[model samples]
Target: MIISWWKETKSIKEVFVVFCRVVALLLILIFALVGLVELFVYLGIAQDGFIIQRD
Candidate 1:
């Protein structure tokens, strides 16, 4: 199954499209991580005095 899918993406256009999709997914993941960190800080779960300090 994987081999067939790889073969289908042998064309340059298909490969470029796949690359763009992967980059987009990575960007989304990074944004999500940053958002989560911000949320934790806003909730007082993470603070400047310590790694994590509940108020």
Candidate 2:
């Protein structure tokens, strides 16, 4: 859960800065994870490889 302390913060500029920082970090982390997964698949390291298994 996100901290609600930002709601009590009194400055718009400060809140916007914090919000931007948080969003940027989230996007960077998500991209890094997706990049890693794609790298693994490209290297054929994932179990079952590119062939989808049927139920």
TM-score of each: 0.71, 0.67
Looking at model 2, residue 41 earns an lDDT score of: 77
> Top lDDT: which candidate number?
1
lDDT (tens digit, per residue) of candidate 1 on 1-55: 3433765776667777877777899999989877787788888897643434346
Q: What 10-residue stretch in candidate 1 is worst by lDDT? A: 46-55
All predictions: root-mean-square deviation over Cα? 5.5, 5.0
Q: Candidate 1: misplaced stretches above 4 Å?
A: 1-7, 48-55
Single out the weakest 10-residue window by summed lDDT for candidate 2: 1-10
Off by over 4 Å in 2: 1-9, 47-55
